[model samples]
Target: MSVQRRKYDPDFKRNAVRLTEDPDRSVQEVATNLGISKDLLYKWRRELRLKEGLAFPGHGKEALTEQEKRIKELEKKLKDAEMERDILKKAVAIFSKAPK
Candidate 1:
């Protein structure tokens, strides 16, 4: 039997991580109160520290890394170029068929 992983909400994770940040409460104590592993709490804190501006992008949305962002940008450019090419092709066909 496979052990199902639990999914925590963004707010819950944020709150739990915030609790770990309190100097008065040790990480182990906070983790026990939140019913999460101490390692998990530490990992979340590390992630929050590293991505202070872009942490927890919410459900159904991916938090892209630098390489992924660059790839997404390039893909958009390619799509725009393809659309322009199609439009120009149609225009050329229309003009060529018109009486000179």
Candidate 2:
């Protein structure tokens, strides 16, 4: 039989995270009392850290700013210019090799 995963209350998670900060009780003890696992406690701590102003990867919102749009446009133009240069070089070679 598959065991059902239990849901923990937000307050319980808060207390569990707080208990981790206490020198007296270890994370495992707090988690056991809260009817959860040490790993879950650690996960909760990570979530708490984010709420406490931690910057986790890919967590920040990105709305393409004006400067960023301009930079992207410029990069595309540069690529187009390179392609044009290559095409011109090929055309020059083809014309130069043709007989009059």
Candidate 3:
């Protein structure tokens, strides 16, 4: 038998982190009340602090900063241009060959 992992939505994670931020509440106290591991809460807090608005991008989704998004777009365009160049080179080579 396997133990299933629990999934928390972005809102729940943000709220949990927010709860941990209360001046009167300890991290362990909030984690215990929320039924999550203290380590998990700490990790969430770290992500929230580090990523700010980009934190908790949800499952199967990536959190990319604006510059990162632009870099990704430019990388894709470069790859496409390189592929097209390769295909054109092959076409030129074939056309330049003498007919048998």
Supply candidate 2's per-residue lDDT for 26.
93
Which regions of candidate 3 fall more than 4 Å away from where they truly are?
65-67, 98-100
Point out where model 2 deviates above 4 Å: 53-100
lDDT of 1 by residue, 1-88 (tens): 9998888877787888888778999999998988889998887788788877567787758788899899999999999999999999
- For candidate 3, write residues 1-100 as lDDT tens digits: 9999999999999999889878999999999998989999999999999999999898768899889999999999999999999999999999999998
**Candidate 2 lDDT by residue in tens digits, 80-99:** 99999999999999989959
Q: What is the C-alpha RMSD of each candidate to the true structure, in Å?
A: 6.5, 7.6, 2.4
Give the total clashing residue pairs for model 2. Answer: 0
Clashes of each: 0, 0, 0
Evaluate all candidate structures by whole-model CA lDDT and list the values in order: 0.86, 0.77, 0.94
Instruction: Quote the lDDT for 44 in model 1.
Output: 79
Pick the winner on TM-score between candidates 1 and 3: 3
Worst 10 residues of 1 by lDDT: 51-60
Instruction: TM-score each candidate.
Output: 0.61, 0.47, 0.75
